[model samples]
Target: MMTGGLSETKSATPEIQDMVDEVKPQFEKKSNEKYDTFEAIEYKTQVVAGIIYYVKVHLGGDQYVHLKILKPLPHTGEPVELLDYQTGKTKDDEVTYF
Candidate 1:
């Protein structure tokens, strides 16, 4: 699974960096616009039995991405899951572009 990135606390990680790299294009496509750059601001994780259940990333421009790491014990693979994408900049932050 995509097992690295956000920390239990508010900090950045290489895993999250990788996630950002992979998800950026999707975000742009979903938003129907392009961002010259993206800066992840904050993130929180939900864990169960010492394993991460999911991650929510707060990016610059008030964009947000929700990810969940899938499990199956692949011999060699990065297991990353994308649950949803959202643009919190809209009125009331209730709208999801994708």
Candidate 2:
């Protein structure tokens, strides 16, 4: 049986790091500050029309940045696209045990 869930990494791979580097300029432009490229707290890879890397980064001040990196298949040698970029503050929740 396979338990489907998000896989997390404390450290980033070269591919992920490269994607982050490429998108940093735009992210900084939009947010008016540099993104914390130190590490990725979590990530997921999805295979659709192409390969997609979903990464979550903590930018301090309760802010979290989510990035989606997409690459086309068949080796067209095209640049990867930052399909989606979003930021949100973390929320706290309480859990109850029964």
Candidate 3:
């Protein structure tokens, strides 16, 4: 993949699901909405100083949210952080850099 460019979007995997779980609380807090169902639908990744993940998540039916999460380089011992997010998204919305 090209440096600093987002990778092609891929369907969510188990690893990606775990990452979503890790940051779900932060997302709920930021959005001020508790989701009864949170599932990762797809995602794209950009290589930076660390890694930026742009994920499309399903919040039950007809509801979705896009999350921007940062995973610091392992050597730095930094926690994965929920950087920002966009609410009121839909299944057709493409997950892109924000």
- What candidate 1 gets wrong by more than 4 Å, as runs, is 1-8, 47-81, 89-98
For model 3, residues 1-98, the per-residue Cα lDDT tens digits are 99899999999999999999999999989888899899999999999989999999999989999999999999999999999999889999999989
lDDT of 3 at 31: 83
Q: Which pairs of residues collide in candidate 2?
A: none
Residue 18 error, candidate 1, Å: 2.1
| Best-performing candidate as measured by lDDT | 3
Model 2 TM: 0.63
For model 1, how does the per-residue alpha-carbon lDDT over 1-98 read when each residue is reduced to its tens digit?
23443334445477666766566676667668776645443345543333342334555454655434333235546445454554444212322112
Clashing pairs in 1: 1-79, 2-79, 4-15, 5-16
Candidate 2: worst 10 consecutive residues by lDDT? 89-98
Better of 1 and 2 by lDDT: 2
Give the TM-score of each candidate: 0.49, 0.63, 0.97
Rank candidates by lDDT, best first. 3, 2, 1
lDDT of each: 0.48, 0.61, 0.95
lDDT (0-100) at residue 5 of candidate 1? Answer: 38
